[model samples]
Target: MTLIGRTHAREIETLSLDSADTRNALSAALVGELADALTDCAGDAGVRAVVLTHTGSTFCAGADLRDPPHPDALVGLLRQIVTLRKPVLARITGHVRAGGLGLLAACDLAVASTRSDFAFTEVRIGVAPAVISLTVLPRTDPRALARHYLTGARFDAAEAVRTGLLTAAGDDVDAVLEPILDGLRRSSPQGLAETKQLLTAKVLEAFDRDAADLTALSARLFSSPQAREGMTAFLERRDPSWAV
Candidate 1:
């Protein structure tokens, strides 16, 4: 199924990655759907907040590396999420890895279940976490960031929260999501828009002004020897030497 976008009368908009059969891999079609949904949500006067989520067990296993969509697409989506003009939240369930960390990190708030897991696994796959790392680094613990991107270690939701990748670990995922939606509902729509813009400016303005440099950065990283080695190791089911 394609990515599904839904908005409620309560002013909560959700964009769900709906290809549950493939673990919701971010393919070209899915990313395009997501981008369109984001644009719609951004322009909607009634949307107070957005909750980004996926349909099943894995929140997202990252981009579809097998005939994956254009590399530029991931960066573009990241930029869209960063520049969107409303509060965005991430609801995490299980086994989030690689660019999934970027998805979690992109949002203003992330709520995870205690059983959920998170990892920045790009380095293990022979690629730098170049696309998502820029936004994630500030929201995460420097040491945890050090371990994650380097080791590709998966930590629990509690650890995710401690590392600032998550705001809280909820006992009941749906229950927690309700209050979060309600809390967002209380904020004035105008205030939410302005706040979102300010938040983006604070984090992205310093370096990513036009996202021009990002292409260079991603190209260098994706083509590096390290990226090749890491991705090969992952496909072969082995630990990457990058950790050693």
Candidate 2:
């Protein structure tokens, strides 16, 4: 299964991406399963919060370029997470890249291991981070976004926090997350829901306004000649022709 869904404490729901074989890559199937799981959690009043997590060393290696890319699916999933009535927390235990960073940005809060790394790598593959920019650009530091989005350089968790992609980074992610979860548990469900709406109004507007165009842009870029060669070279473990 690409995703595993479970509820604990009668209130905390966890939807873990389990496609370790692909480093939990955002295949259409995985994204669909995630969307379904999140929808189920959203409609269940017993579920007060959702934890987005993954198994294996790589949290998510962006899109599975070998398969058809479905940028709309990712865009919808990010929207779902951001607009969810209950709080969504990302638990990162490993490396995150490209589209995965968008997932981190969507969550209301994220706690990552100090060893975890991140990058916005779409540009390296001849495509831009179009759809993700809707959510990521709102949270990321403008200067950091300019440098990392263009260079695709790997950055550490501390920088992730400083740039607003994460709430905290530590040796023990669970320890860092416990306090946040406890605080969430104390809030009334109605209060959380209303507060979340206040916090996410701008993001919802951005999604409504920009998702379609960005999704189209992502689709076009992925199908471009340069992207084809870049993806091919990446899968073959070689540098693209344009690499300096």
Task: List, residue by residue over 1-244, the lDDT tens digit for candidate 1.
Answer: 5467465667888777787877887778887888899899889888888898877898988877664656578777877788788888888777788777877888888887888887776756666676676578767889877987787777788888888889888888878788878877888877877887877775576336635566577678766888777767766888778665
lDDT of each: 0.77, 0.89
Best by TM-score: 2
Write down the RMSD of all candidates, one decimal each: 2.4, 1.1
lDDT of 2 by residue, 15-121 (tens): 88898989988888888888989889989988989998888998889888876448877888899999899999999999999988888899999999999999999
TM-score, cand. 2: 0.97
The regions of model 2 sitting more than 4 angstroms off are 5-7
Measured against the true structure, the TM-scores of the candidates, in listed sequence, are 0.88, 0.97
Window of ten residues with lowest summed lDDT in model 2: 1-10
The best candidate in terms of lDDT: 2
